[model samples]
Target: MSASVTSTPVDHAPRVPAAPDTAITAVADMARRARVAGRVLGHAGAEQRNAALCHAATALRDARAELLAANARDVAAFSGAASFRDRLILDEARIEAMARGLEDVAKLPDPLGRVLAEWTRPNGLKIRRVATPVGVIGMIYESRPNVGADAAALCIKSGNAVILRGGSDSINSARVIHAAMQAGLRAAGLPVDAVQIPPDTDRRHVADMLAASGLIDLLIPRGGKSLVERVCREARVPVLSHAEGLCHTYVHAAADLEMARRIVLNAKMRRTGICGATETLLIDNAIAPVLLPGLVEDLATEGCTFRADARARAIVPDLPPATEQDFATEWLDAVMSIAVVDGVDDALAHIVRYGSSHTEAIITEDEAVATRFLNETDSAVVMWNASTQFCDGGEFGFGAEIGIATGRFHARGPVGLEQLTTFRYEVFGNGQVRP
Candidate 1:
């Protein structure tokens, strides 16, 4: 006999106020509209979608000054912490980059309806595995207003609908970008709901989107640890959570001192605010005394602050002391933690203990060591003789990305256009049935 579990009456009681009912209903309705839009987008040819992207790019480029003015209003209104300000500020370069990104995505090969695999069975049956969009994607992100345009363009190009929830600090900027997206969609004869931004900036709307499991196909949280943790905990839907990127760069004993120095300096100081920037530096003890000072001094000269452990401090006595929290922190600023380990094994252990599994790099001429590090480190991107900052989608030739996915399943590493798609099997059988 089989047993079935049933919910009691108390379990079916009236819904408690997890979030406001009105906001929840609005998000739900928007999701429904997006889902319908996604169906239309799914069947639309690549030419049509590409045309939309081209129009969007043109619109953004032509209205750069207007967009900047709107972004300035949002920046002026922000009374939040410096961290929020850091993420929200938009300049002419970023807007131009956003427009160029849309143009790049428009030129790339369309991912929808591509045949992944095809096979024939013994019974003369044919099976085709075709790639399809993931339907409606709910993006809950912080600060960066550019993410609004990037996410919408990527989703539309891949034949999926996007519901963007940007931080309140960039609401005005997001609204302006969203208006451009709508114009693009309308120009291509697609529904404006294909890309929708939240009408309100209330945090409760985020809670509502998180809890809307059935309506939202996938939830992608892009921000700090607290936001990702909250979304992971509260979301009833499948979440592609992007946690803090505690990236690391290991300098092997056999590494070229010059190469290691260059790699370390670029990895930590190239752009501290990006997720792929190295937050920690691990040096083999054999090379620390010989190569440590130069690397530290080089980074310090470039305006990077270091928090060193006991072993690392022994090499540079004047360096600031690193706490247990420092190893665990993802200082998305001009800050990094340094440690001296014995060898590859020790380095691996340290990374497993502290890494967010986002990206890790090793500087070594030894093929065996490089192969081992690449194979062992369970990060989304494992590089050898290169900086961790190379872990970007644009750098990887994907044009642009929604963001890097630190999670294991679905999309790992850079979340590009191809990663945004899911596959389905289409089997063609000639009179085949189960016995």
Candidate 2:
């Protein structure tokens, strides 16, 4: 999808600050530096860019322990509730994963300068759409320090500059990762400003990034609903915004009970704090009696908590009552909501009304049912007989992602290296005239 203006701006609304003005100004200056660097990067050879990514991979691997140590400081200093603590904590495995992501990005083909499409007219006019970097990107995210590395690596690989504004809770970790990325850039004889983490941890800087529409080509907010909503409402710049992941998994009557059971358990409990985790399980009424009981019991054994509708509660009397909010919530925890729909139509209707249009799945043996679900679901990623967690970019073999965009304009699914690029028309003409 291409970017374009949709409407006129209105009154200013209250926005969540990303940092203090002093810090915001420093970051803006850093971003300006990166923009200059990006001009060089945009023309840099693919081999040089790959070399930088290779260096980043090595730096990340060598600094793994130091990175983890820095992350530990952030985790220890976290004063928020349990949920915040969960988001703040990072371990050796997560750090290693970040390094691996950088290495994988290094392996992918460079997206910059590649010719996407071309055409020639009868009047001897020719046009080619070539991929180009999207310029400086301001990523405002929360808690997850690993995102800093991921965003930096993806932007660098795609030949775009990046400015990261991570949550205050993860300042230390973000700093360490950002330093490693700069080291990689310098090692490849590239400008260190190519990847920057703002010195300010105050919340107002997010506003500055958003308001600097001419400077930041895109503002990607990669956190919860409130953060994304704030960016969408306040940012004058274009936003590839993604809100909640109130994802769903529908178990149709034709579904294999065992497969449905396993998929549901994995989808909901494998990792609950991610956007792709299934928050609601929609079971066909025909299969609800036969499959619901076992599914609920299976999930319970895995330490999962559930809020069930009347039908589900009847089947599993010990289940907690499901509320309206439960159906609409993206419980990024060990909690899930259950409802029994009449059939495929009801399931589709329910998802259309309540889903966040992030990821949705259907478990069915009938090809027609599965096909319908896939075709009808209006989400960035849709699946049949697969877990919602598969919506991730890494799983889709893109190395890493900026974030999963649920919008229709620029990108819909995983915003990976390819998604980070915008196409420009390259035209060639031999004495062609408009007349």
Candidate 3:
């Protein structure tokens, strides 16, 4: 079954303790309030929802100083992996981008109440598939407090209520950001409960949220393997898995060296911590000798460490040898794996072997080769002559993303406004009965 859906969330809530009993009641109550708010938001017209989004955008922009200040505290107090620390920090540009994301979501066409499809039966019965909200969604994420803003805004725009559980490291920033977003909802006459974060930075509360099966219609996990694995394992509600974006970029024989060099750099280094960053680099044996040196040198110059397979190691003699484990890993940092393949078939086979079905890109000028790679690679997002990083909701014109789904069913790639909706069949009959 598909998992996208939500309603309004609660706001200005105080932080509570992480005790299991307290967490059970508090998270359950949060779900209860969100359910009530979701009903109201579900039927709210486009104008009202759009106004709420605009207010949210304004609120985010106005709260920039406060957000940056809060983020500073969060960053200073953080003592985790540098990759995660990077995700936690929110500078001026990032905050502004969050605000613009809200504005962008506000400008998109309303996803609700639209007819997706229609058909007429022989009995003169007309039926149409119309989009509707999924009711209440539980978003359990770690690090990256901006996810709070993005998730909250997208849930509001899609007519779903979201219950956010940001990482404990980002608890303070989450609380502040959640409050500012709620202020916008309140200002726009929307229910504050329509978008709620945990009252406390409690891990127990996350368990409570996971166990709240019937109350939460869907659960989306956005984080590292451990976090996503825990949610998928414990959540009683349907969980949408983004998985590790073990993304890759294949430098094919037909690839233009210049284009391949640029795309590889951007795909890997543009934002190493993001899920869309290519974790593995595959070069065709036909082009390995010619392309590997320049490309390897370019990335190395930018402080990227390379782990290469035997075939690729021949081309870059000084590169550290990659293990089987390296090809399967999602470095989520500046580290990446490289393998040399024979041709399109070889590259495709390797991707199928190691890909997380997240995103994959092929840098080539030949339409036939690009088409083969795109068709053969079983990733949610397959790119041709472009960076895998483009596999984002905003780039796809969805304002911001809740997360990118790697699952094959329901939704894949970027989960945005349209992906956050469900559908029902509405039938119009002229006093007709089934034969």
Candidate 4:
């Protein structure tokens, strides 16, 4: 699904400084240079920007050996949970995806200077809403060094400067990739500072970035629950984020058993470590007896644990009881939670209470049920008879995404080049003054 955000509210607050420590000072310096870089990049022209992106894609391909060596160091140094290491590790295909993402962005239509809205006043004045860059954006993420490349490429192509801060585990890999992006910018005769990565990944630098209100026009956090929570809570800059993805897939009574099974399996198990992975499965009570048991047995054999509510347990007899906390948790792993709802209405109520508003899916053959589920659900992306895993930018043909924003205000769903730009009103008049 495409996002509908064409503009955002301007942050009118003044910048305030924290204690003058060396770490924060360095981060602030980077923000200032990014602002300057944004100005230069805004005028770099679409041709120059596309050339830069092409150069970056080639650079990544040429530097494949060096990139892998750095990533190996990152993989060895990771000390977090086993699931987290999955995000840190990079392979040849992942690097290829990164490069292709840059090339894909270059192929997208220029987001800037496009007229989004236009009108004429009775006083012979013509006004048009034109897209403009959002200025300097700070992309803070934990793990997933590929995000560093994607973020930089999107911001650069959309006429905005960017400051990247990857998790410490992938800092070395991030540096190598960030340098390649800078080389591309310089080769295109654009400012190298257009895409800057902090020299250090200290926690203090992240704090500094949160308070960099004036320097950073927008804050996009791409990481786990903790990282996203910290940014949303303390960030002084305007933020576009969702704290976590407690995504769900509801299997309705009218759903075809085969379609329901395939959709649910892929939704939860295709890549459980991602934000789009479905964590909770709600089966319509009328159909639970006919369908839930076999689905559980097959997934159990495939290494997925099922935590179910009392009603579901009564039918299946083997699922571990799901806790209240489990219903609200975003388990970015192979564990799945199951529940039985009375009908489509009950299913929607359960989702409202426990869902993250990130992504939700309904498997149903009834047109009325599918339409209601899609219309009534308050999520960034909603699906019908499709896996929630499809809520991705590359899948939407945007090369790659900055993040899947669940915030309804500035940006929502898959954040791509279009979501990254805001608009300004351009008025044409023959020396007309306000009456």
* Model 4 Cα lDDT, one tens digit per residue, 14-102: 23345467555777877877777788888779999998888888878777888899999999988888777888888999999898889
**Which lDDT tens digits does candidate 3 get at residues 1-435?**
111111244443333234466434778888888887888788888888888877877767777777778888889899998888999998888888887888888899999999999999988999999999999999988899999999998999889989998988888778777877777777777788888877777678888888998889999999998888888888888988876889999998999999999999999999999999999999989888988999988999998998999988887789999889999999999998999998998888898898899999999989998998888888899999999999999999888999999987689999999999999999999899776
Best by lDDT: 4
Name the lDDT of candidate 3.
0.87
Estimate the overall C-alpha local distance difference test score of candidate 2.
Answer: 0.84
Q: List the residue pairs that clash in candidate 2.
A: 17-203, 17-204, 18-202, 18-203, 18-204, 19-202, 19-203, 19-204, 19-205
Write down the TM-score for model 2: 0.93
Please identify model 2 stretches exceeding 4 Å from their true place: 1-24, 81-84
With candidate 4 superimposed using the best TM-score fit, by how many Å does residue 427's alpha carbon deviate from the native?
A: 1.0
For every candidate in turn, the CA RMSD to the true structure comes to 9.1, 7.8, 5.1, 6.3
lDDT of 2 at 230: 93
Q: Over the stretch 330-351, how does candidate 1's per-residue lDDT look in tens digits? A: 9998888999999999999999
Clashes of 2: 9
Assess the local accuracy of residue 285 in candidate 2 as a C-alpha lDDT between 0 and 100: 90
- TM-scores of the models, in the given order? 0.93, 0.93, 0.94, 0.94
Could you give candidate 2's per-residue lDDT for residues 154-272 as a string of tens digits? 99889998889999889988877777777677677777677777676877688788888677898899998999999999999899968989999999999999999999999998888
As a whole number from 0 to 100, the lDDT of residue 59 in candidate 3 is 69
Candidate 4 local lDDT, residue 432 = 91
| Cα lDDT computed for each candidate against the true fold | 0.86, 0.84, 0.87, 0.87
Name the weakest run of 10 consecutive residues (lDDT summed) in model 4.
1-10
Q: Rank the candidates by lDDT, best first.
A: 4, 3, 1, 2
